[model samples]
Target chain A: MATTEVVVSILVSTLIGGIIIGYLSQRSRMCFVGGVRDYVLVKDTHLLKAPLAFLIGAVVVFAIASLVASMPTWPWFITKSLMPIPGAPLAANAAVPIYNHIILAIIGGLGIGIFAVFAGGCPLRQHVMASEGDKSSMLYLLGFYIAAVVFMAFILPNIQIF
Target chain B: MTEQKERKRIIKHSYLIIIAGLVTGLIAALLQITAGVGPPNAPVAYGICIACHGRDLINWIVNAIGGTNLGYGTLVAGVPVLTVVGIVAGAFISSTKNKEFKFRTTKNPGVSFVCGFAVMASALILGACPLRAVLRVAYGDAIAVVGFIAISVGVVISAAVIKVNARRAINREVT
Candidate 1:
């Protein structure tokens, strides 16, 4: 297929996949951070099982996928440089130092963890809860959207570890 | 009786989580294979992420209507990923269908909003949300592992604090 066709196909696939995921998540009440929190605080394995299964399922599928296609960048740490996968600032480039990425990951992960606990769920959970007509989650998403713009404009530039 | 119990266990919520996780992996792999990643749609494990994909979707719309070039992942350069949109739609449909949909208001909208803002800022800094972090770890990224560990630590810390506060409240009531 042509590039445009491929993009469209991927978009449709993602939408469908997302629908499946969202439906399942709603039914299951699957929240990764919640799982970790529950297990840590109460030793409740009930919620914890889902995220572990998620990790295992993804790993097994990813391993199989590598055999079917030429995943040159599949195992990114070994194939590419030690820098984390490109989802952050300078995502497409390798200009940022390795340590910067590490530091960013630490700070980012901690912030997400702490705030998400207070917010009552992770991002995915918040989105689902908002859809369920939770007014608080809707407000949460409002801030989430606004912060995306603010991060790109204000926070991203200053945090560049030059 | 045992057969019925077995049937119920098979249809448990955890099973749905497992299916969702496997399907998520399959979607990511299929996108990579068919779309031919790198340029215009980079980032491995780009299938399903709440934070990154959500940001990309917003950026795509803003850039389209406002004609402003806000930077975003190359994957959504042409069209935004609709995973988050689909999530909301799907969740809404499922909740209503299951009669689980209810309008629940919060006492602390401002606090929730601030927490949301902070969560997004940190997630972007890390460059992935929890779901994406798991994907990266599965894809063999070492840094994501560190991030995951730090996230666990943070969760533990907060959970402990919350537990302590709850206990204190109980103690005060007893007094």
Candidate 2:
């Protein structure tokens, strides 16, 4: 297929996939931050189980599909490979860029995690909620997209922080 | 006999839903990461990344408006935006069909908006959505671990604060 054709095909596939996910997520009330929050605060495994199920499902499918795609070799199983720890023999040439990964990934992840809860849900949850006419979610997406645009136009250009 | 029969049916129905969810999740993840698809119109800072999807998409729009990227990079005309749009559309359709669609307003829109800004900023910084971080890790992206651990820690810390506040509220009421 041509590049455009492939792009079209992928977009359609992604759309349908998104629809399916949207429906399933809606039906299941899939909210990631809420799941973790419930698990931690209330000892409720109920909501937490949904994300776990999705994670397991996605991981299995992704791992298999990665075989079909030309890609980088994965550097982890369940954790950062212990063998690649700084000062370890493999650390010197390890695929993991320790400094960048530590700074961006950790800080970014913490931001997403904490703010998602504060926002009441992650993007997936918020978008769907927005569609359901949740005013807060609608307001949230406004900020979400604007921040994204600003980041690309201004923040990224000035700072080489990935 | 009727109670037992109902219980069994509920369990069976739930298992079916789970299987269906798994199938759809797999298909969606597969399609999103298809190698058949070419690169975005502009130089993408990242690929197959959900957090950056919105950013790339907005950049595409900006480039389109200006008719050129002004040398920042080749700005693409599009990204995986349709998928994000599709998600909302599908959920709306499903919810409407299921009679679960409702208009709910939060008492605190300002708070939600600020939190939303933070969430977007963090996701952009991390370069992937926390939700889809699972797929990245599954692909053996070791860098995802730092984000994952940080996210979990964030959740735990917030949960602790929430519990403390709840206890404080209870004490005030009792006193």
Candidate 3:
């Protein structure tokens, strides 16, 4: 297949997937942290089930796609190697370190967890909510976009400790 | 007698939750298998995430501002836009059918804004969020796995803080 055809097919598939996800999320209220929160706070396990469902769904679909369609499963670079994009500063000369850095990992994790709570959703939740026509979610997404720009331009440069 | 029916309802709800969880996991695993390790081929990341794409966007922006010639992150960024557009359109259709489309707000707008900033910033720094992070980890991305663990810890800690705050608010109300 031509490159453009592949790209188009991918886009179409993604759109279909996104649409299905949006519909499911809207109907199911599938928020990852929210599910946990609901279960913890009220003992209501309804929300908690969505993430589990999503995971299971993704795994099954991925397995089938891999077996029949020759779909790529698990990119090797993300795991075993870090391809230093020619001049990128963040690109490491060595393999990206994998494990045993508990402190930094914990700190980063805590930061994400707290922020998700405050944001009233995780990244996945934001997408789902945005799909459901939440104007505030749109605003949150705008923040996300701006932050991405800022991180690349300013913050990343200053933060030597990654 | 009525309590028995209520108990049954709760059990059914629990069953639904379990089923959904299984399905979601299966789909996620499938996506991982299909996308492989290199850049995703279709829908450009196979419903992966905005964070990874956003990281590429940042890389492009950095290269542009620094006047260094680099590959544009358009493919990564553009896919999310398409997916999100599809999502909004889907939701619109669903909401219209269900008659649930209404503008609403919470009492704490400032908090929400801060939360949004923090979430985006953290996700950007880590190079992915929970969904993408988990997917990456499943695919054998070590950094992503670390990031996922970090996010989980973050969530648990934040939940604790929220609990405390809620308690304080309750006490204030009582007084």
**Top-lDDT candidate index:** 1
lDDT by residue for model 3 over A1-162, one digit each (tens)? 226555565456556655665565565556666765566557776776666555556545554565676544334354336321111123222344433233434454566778887777776677667656677776777777666666666766676453
Error of 2 at B134 (Å): 0.9
Q: Write down the lDDT that model 2 would get.
A: 0.63
DockQ, all models: 0.66, 0.41, 0.42
The recovered share of true contacts, given per candidate in order, is 0.70, 0.60, 0.46
For candidate 3 chain B, the 10 contiguous residues with the lowest summed lDDT are B36-45
For each candidate in the order shown, give its overall lDDT on alpha carbons.
0.79, 0.63, 0.56
Off by over 4 Å in 2: A62-97, B1-17, B32-50, B66-81
Best by DockQ: 1
Q: By DockQ, is 1 or 3 better?
A: 1
List model 2 lDDT by residue over A30-49, tens digit each.
Answer: 66667778788778765565
Better of 2 and 3 by TM-score: 2
For B1-175, candidate 3 gives per-residue lDDT tens digits of 9999999988876675566445445544543343321244322223455555444545556566787443323353333224455555666677767877776655666666666777766665454566666555444455555666677667667778888899999999999
**What tens-digit string does per-residue lDDT give for candidate 1 at A45-143?**
766666666677667766776787566777777787587877776344567667877887899999999999989989999999998999999999999
Instruction: Kindly report which residue stretches of model 1 are placed more than 4 angstroms away from their true locations once superposed.
Output: A90-93, B1-11, B35-40
TM-score for each of the candidates = 0.91, 0.80, 0.74
What lDDT, from 0 to 1, does candidate 3 have?
0.56
